[model samples]
Target chain A: MKARDLMRRDLTSVEPDTLVHEAVYIMEQSGLSTLPVVDEEGKLVGIITEHDLIQAALPEYFEMLHSVTFLPNLNQIQKRLKEMAFKPVSEYMKEVFSVHLDDEDLHIADLLIRKRLKQIPVVDGEGHLVGVIRRIDILSRLIR
Target chain B: MILTVTLNPTLDKFYWVEKLPLSLERVEEEILIRAYKSWGSAGGKGINVSVFLACMGVETVAMGFLAGHTGQIILRDLLEKGVTANFVWIEGENRTNVTIIEKGKEYHPVKIHEEGPRIPTHAQELFLKKYRRMLKRAEYVVLAGAIPPGIPETAYRELALEAKEAGVKAVVHAGRRALWEAVKTGPFFVKPDVREELVVGDMPVRTEEEIISAGKKAIEYGCSACLISHHVTGDILITPEGIWEYEIGVPPTAFKNLVGADDALVGGIIYKLLQGEEIPEAVRYGMAAGAASLEVEAKMCLSPAAIEQEMKSIKMEFKEPL
Candidate 1:
């Protein structure tokens, strides 16, 4: 089956300029890990993922210090969250990857396996999001 | 203290735009109107519940999983509100959720959500350890919202069972598979939104009767009580005594945003329950809190007077089967 066959059509998306918290709520409610960022015309311009958000939340030395101690400073965490919380999603969103509708399922599966991605958004030739294919979709339906 | 569990907590952002230029225009020529107001707060079902509870003068503790930078935002937000934060620190970053509201779009706001960090097994174990410690003081525990990745769907069930083992009453406000699993653990109460479905329940609940029937079945399945919301149809509260029906007529809508309404409803119920009110009065208070939620933009707390006034309009009926 093509990627479109197994893709989810009903989508939840946001404009890039949308503030950070609004975008976060949309993703949380939709239960999507990644959101395809679109312009007003619904054409994909960029994409945001949980990784991008987590990166935004973390300080520069987060990875270096995460293993150092389980009890990180509470004051520092709160201060950073307050500072980054109001920023626009455009500031934190990544120009990440997307798949085309006509791409072969095997090709898409290769991308997923190579990248270890959970889901990839699908777009038409016009760059309009048609659907999304998740790794779970592929595993549940195609991976004999 | 009332403890709330948000397995997938998030950083919530709200943007209010006067007019969004939907059409493609020359960037040099078009004067685009961007957002005039934006609000930032911690976001999660459990966090929102704690926010509401704290606003209503209830002592609430916001707990669950947090990772990376966004988790800090959640902690700060909760601490700022004076809600206790007892979260299990994780290795991944918490997600950021955004909502974009245009002037004309009252009900349909643009929402973008990021899936939260996957819970490593070690982190999950740490959370259980924390939960055990917190349960010693927690009289009421609310296990709300989604179960993050890398965690089994039975996560809520196990948490509810743990709360029960600690002699704490568990309240669930969730949807679909998570709600199904939570109900099986025999929570004190379960509230399911009709717009969402309990897929594990295997019932396509639509009308009032369907909603009631579903609640009845949920009680039979295991939970002590169930509240099924038929969105526009009606809301049914099923318990061992009988079914308490509440029809929330057209909300007293001064302004409408559905974002925190469920949290408000659940918070209201918990608020009255903490005050030692009977089930009917507490549900009535909950109905008013929910209706009052529509009157304002998402506020940290609903006004007590507004809830009292809105309670005047809501008609709650108790139907005890003979």
Candidate 2:
């Protein structure tokens, strides 16, 4: 199967000026975990995922402060979260991944495995958001 | 004059694209999207209230800590909306909020907030100093939104108290921690989300009865009135005299890409209250404004004439305070 045949035509996306906090709300409301970040011209600039947001919201030293001597500061983490509350998603979205409409499903799935991406956006030749294909969409290809 | 204190403000941008993919497995990673449309406007709780107030023909002033290029954009937009502003200059840039709406039948709406710049101690003082001067001439003062870092939770309380002492009614909408402090100052009114009871008040208010009981305690602390907004179930209004339940009768007309519905509610209430309308009438006006915002694609308020028509469908039931 090719990406065009397997990819779902519907896509979730946001603008560069969109806040990361509101992105979380959209994901939760829509029950989707990923969103493509587009610029004013509708060009796909980056992609944001649940992991990207959670990691960005956390304090920089969150994983490193497990020691009892200097425990993780709740106040610092709260401050980080509050700060993230007003930040735009353009700051942390991944710009490296995207797929062409005619790309083969095998290549797309291989890229998903290599990058550990949950969703890959399908775009037309003009870089317009057309659809999306997730990891499971092509799993049937391997099974059969 | 109505003074809106948005300690932190942002540029709100909206982008319309396609319907969201529900299942993760259904989509590919990279997609180019042709943005059908995009828009930007004023954001921040107090700023939104000011925008709505201006739409209702009220003279409103927006105040807050602003800095950098993003702040300038917000200031320019505020002026475009006919709201005068005097923001305290601070270091770093202001934040931007993005709202993404999918254009299909679902009308999926996703919002993202940027982590705003932190205000320095000196900048905080400058803002408060401005607050002191403006409170003296203000007829109504609105305190709203999340308290930015380095600013104490008591910030709203202090502002609200200043308004009260000046014989101006203060309306505050904030989270639990700030709400607790603000209620003690006894602004004319306090409106916290229904979930706030668990976060800031003495009880968890899921049902109507619980909301009234918890809201009463908040009112008795300092304010003359309180409102609890439950977006889906509707809202509850309480005062020392009695309590009332507001039924929008229908959901917000436009849910997608609709921001500031709550702020419009706050603005509508203040508009009617300043005109000497009763609490129930004011509450109705608030509901209509909120409903009007639901259908709009941008973060703009409905005109009073339009809201007046929507107000007819709102039903209010006065449940005597328990």
> Model 2 misses residue A125 by how many Å?
63
RMSD of 2: 20.2
The 0-to-1 C-alpha lDDT of every candidate, in the order given, reads: 0.75, 0.75
In candidate 2, what are the lDDT values of residues B1-322, reduced to their tens digit? Answer: 8999898798889888765554566366654555588888878999999988877778787888776778767876876676766566566788888877787532346778887888778567646655666676688888998787778878888888777777888888887778778888777888784432444455666776677777788777866788887445388888888888887755433454457878888999898998999877898889888876675676755677778887877888887853
Question: In model 2, which runs have C-alpha deviations exceeding 4 angstroms?
Answer: A1-144, B22-28, B31-34, B104-108, B194-202, B231-233, B252-254
lDDT of 1 by residue, B7-33 (tens): 999888888988766677776686656
Encode model 1's per-residue lDDT on A2-65: one tens digit a residue.
8656665433465677677666654664455787777655577887887787666666677877
True contacts preserved, each candidate? Answer: 0.00, 0.00
- lDDT value, residue B201 of candidate 2: 57
lDDT of 2 by residue, A43-138 (tens): 678898887876776655656874334635567656777788678888888775889988987799889999988888887797866567888778
**Could you tell me the lDDT of residue B216 within candidate 1?**
76
After superposing candidate 1 on the true structure, give the runs of residues whose Cα lies further than 4 Å from its correct spot: A1-144, B20-33, B198-200, B232-234, B249-253, B320-322
